[model samples]
Target: MTYAITQTCCADATCVAVCPVNCIHPTPEERDFGSTEMLHIDPKTCIDCGACADACPVDAIFPVESLSAAQREYGPLNAAYYEGREAGSVTSGPNFHAWGEPVFERVLPSGFAPVRVAVVGTGPAGMYAVEDLLLHTGAEVTLIDRLPVAGGLIRYGVAPDHPSTKKVQDVFARFHAHPRVRMHLGLDVGKDVTHRELAAHHDAVVYAVGAGADRRLSVPGEDLPGSLSARTF
Candidate 1:
């Protein structure tokens, strides 16, 4: 079976850059690039070399045979993307540079007003969403976090020595100063403030709360001082 792109794909296009056969459709250069929800692998043309899988930073690509139950549908979804393409649509090779950068313009409806959104977390994901929304719309964003200090696990979990990895924090920190973006720190949504409260203040509430929990082991001393999660270590 061919490789498939799953839900975790943020459309960074790293897979397209490394793919040898150029079987992945909708390269950033294509007309439907930003319009499509996710990138798709051409099952018919994919050589299944697994290069794209290696290049994916988020591990969103998988060989069809190895797909988990939740990711199985991605195989068909990848195939479906190609079905909608025009008959003559095909990329030559390594045309990612040709795609150029995505240009977004705000197209508002008549009598419309600026939207308001309350994001539940201030981590990379939430901030990235804020950055994307601000670039596309005239929306006011309220970033809510339970901790007194922001940055989430990125500030606490990442090693101090890894400067390059943590450098992304600097980029995210800029949103805090944006006029349309507001920060609500030391505020728990359910305990400090109700969901209804946020709903009354905004058009939508987005939960970008990251997955940082440590799973349990049946062995003794699992909670000992020496024991630590990878996220904490």
Candidate 2:
């Protein structure tokens, strides 16, 4: 059976890097990659190797046969992405994501002091920024979150039924204990620590705090009791 990419995709492109046959479409280098909500797998070219499923950071990929009733539509959705496009079309030169030359030069100048950075959130975005800083730069990171626990959206946003989706939290937890990282939880930015205070201590303060607004259905009784938004429930 072929694998399918579902809506939980973060568009991180980790899956694309591992697919041996290159069945996943719209590699990060492609012009359309940014516009597409999620990447799709070409069923015709998929060899059922499951490499993409293993590499997916958000657990968005799965076998077509295992899709639940709500997710069954994704199987067709993945196939629909390549309706008119020819097989092996993504492997062509223009769409191929080729590796670039690596530069070993230091980003910081000689005698430059290491900077302190503060990332405000513990979700995927915040953790990614933390990972990039620790791996690519010499910045010391201070991680902050209003909740007592970490894993902002991954902990609260995802449904409990989908345990696999929540597994990504383990990946983010690694950076929490990094030597260069200092974590503060249950600390409100404005009440506990003001923006001016953070700016004073850090070279840069990144606000990865996710959106708080809910979508409007514009229908009667949408706001009535027993009605719950995705985050509210």
Candidate 3:
């Protein structure tokens, strides 16, 4: 029997450090680690130790025997990642600070107090809002996103080849690295956490969620197979 990591897995790779046999594929250091939607466990090498399940921060790992009917699909997804790979084939590199460490010794403004704030998204607008709030107001910001990974639409919607536009992700990354920022990835505000809960935790809530679906144009044959919306491809 083997355990599998599911959709809820954040790809943080905390479980990879604990597994005795290293059955988890795309470990944080792998090239695919940054791009993979979720982590996968190798069934052939798994010893059913359950260490991965124990280490998962989001409760995404589950043993084969314990998996609910709804989670059965993850079993194949996990195993498929390693179907053709040789044992111990995966590897990762050392953490190189390509962008030099941020200057931390600089003095901050006096009379600036930290304000508890909640930001509802992690996209360009949300990140920029948080960055401005922190730099200007010293607000303690909590950024929330529904996807397990942050960077919002940049992660899911942006095409990989758009490197120039993708550079904006670095801005979000800086916001995420700020000491005043707390990220709640994989959480849906109205579903996983309520507005009341946020109200209780924060002095104020700022909804920086970007515009939703693009306005639709109504015309004949709009539903044809070749049709695609500006908001979605």
Candidate 4:
């Protein structure tokens, strides 16, 4: 049996770093890491170490034996990522930076004091909010994302070919890389860290989460498989 990284599992690589046998694939450092929706555990190599479960901040990791019926599909989904792997499959390079590294550079106005702020989502809104906050105050920013990686919909929801729009992720990378900012990746505020915890840690909490679902088209066959909303598409 093996532990499966679930829908809530962020592709942050915390589990990958902790795994003794290196069973997890598409670690944040890998090229495909940024593109992957979530981290996938290699069941064949898992050894049932439980390191992944321990490392996961959102508690998204679960042993196969203990997986609820709803989560059972994740077991195959994780393995499917490496289905075609030959003896020597090429691996992608790391796409994300370490906690303290500079992902980008920013200019600030003179005489600013660090403000303590917590911004959620790490998407365009979150990135822009943090950027504005940084310029306005000397803020100790904590950027939180449910996924292991920071970029939100830009990483998961966006189409890969949309490079122009995807550039926004770079902006977020730099914001996260900022010295004043502390990126709390994989931390789901309500779960890994609570609202109260955030209130105690920061002077204010700014929620940048986007709208969850779009207004339905309200037409026939809208529920069919071919139908997709702007957000879903």
Please name the candidate that would achieve the greatest TM-score relative to the true structure: 2
Better of 1 and 2 by TM-score: 2
Off by over 4 Å in 3: 1-113
- Please give, for residues 50-159, the per-residue lDDT of candidate 2 as tens digits: 98999887789999999999899999999999999877634546334344588776588877888899999999899999998999888999999998999989998989
lDDT tens per residue, model 4, 129-210:
8877877666788888887877777877778776544654664577777888888777877887789988997888999877
Tens-digit lDDT track for model 1 on 50-96? 99988775577899999999778999999988786653345666542
* Candidate 1, residue 29: how far the Cα is off, in Å: 8.6
**lDDT of candidates 1 onward, in order:** 0.80, 0.89, 0.76, 0.74
Error of 3 at 186 (Å): 2.3
lDDT of 3 by residue, 156-212 (tens): 577777554465576468778788888888888899999999999898998877755
Q: Which stretches in model 4 have alpha-carbon errors above 4 Å?
A: 1-113
Taking all chains together, each candidate's TM-score versus the true structure is 0.57, 0.76, 0.47, 0.46
Error of 3 at 106 (Å): 18
Top candidate on lDDT is 2
